[model samples]
Target: MPKSLTTSEPNVLRPEDFDPPLKRKEPIVPYYWTLDEIATELGVTSRRVGYDITGYPPRKIQPSLKAYKAGSLFLVPDADALAYIQRFRERKKS
Candidate 1:
């Protein structure tokens, strides 16, 4: 038999030799939500949520008049809520 040409060590791997697992992505739900619930998800008070959307296109929902001001029992999309939640998390990390 011919002699082995390679001089490198064998490529055997032990259970402890493995690298740590990668971080998993945050889970996303496929549901719409009301402002109160969205505020909870973003870790903020509901008043702040109201302020965040002020002078912006309102969330799609039936409009009701609260005295002279308008209000919505409408649902905001999960993606929009997630974007706000992401900002909240980043702010907390600093």
Candidate 2:
């Protein structure tokens, strides 16, 4: 039997022996909002988020929202949400 397995040898797994997961060179910063969150923020429903993306002419739902699609999920950055709401007042005034 190997000395490492049979005996408590110094070569046994140590804290320094393991390699950590690879990290990105640059720091990562993510600020995102889900469709459900957007709905709640605007006092609406997730279904309304979809409608806002694609306006419903008959329902008088106009598409005026920005969203980022990562795969099947949609995300709205915090900055964008603020801008969207800020522009809302300007657009209404116009």
Candidate 3:
């Protein structure tokens, strides 16, 4: 048998050597949406998402849950954007 050429110690796995699993505080569902994402999800242009505020009812006619802005980049949380569209439909149907 040939002599071993490597000098590094073996990396044997042990139960006590492992790190604890990560704990998550937030929901698993995708959280935030940019203007482009909102448009893609709703099948419209990014400009439309920016203009319509996630398809919120017109601000003048109804209270609006407007899109958010972060670090000069506009964003809309996924939940809020979907809610805005739902409420828009609800309002229009009535």
Q: Say which candidate scores most in TM-score.
A: 2
Full candidate order by TM-score, most accurate first: 2, 1, 3
| Over 4 Å off, model 2 | 1-29, 85-94
The digit string of per-residue lDDT tens for model 2 on 1-94 reads: 1245666764332223223311222212356666766565455588877777667899999988778887777777656654554454345569
TM-score of 1: 0.45
Stretches of model 3 off by over 4 angstroms after superposition: 1-30, 54-65, 87-94
TM-score of each: 0.45, 0.49, 0.43
RMSD of 1: 17.1
Off by over 4 Å in 1: 1-30, 55-71
lDDT, candidate 3, 1-94, per-residue tens: 1235685564433223223311223333356656665555455577655766534455543334566677755766655755655544456569
Is candidate 1 or 3 superior in TM-score? 1
Model 2 C-alpha RMSD to native: 20.0
lDDT at residue 56 of model 3 (Cα atoms): 45
Better of 1 and 3 by lDDT: 3
Candidate 3 clashes between residue pairs 3 or more apart in a chain or in different chains: none
- When 2 and 3 are scored with lDDT, the better candidate is 2
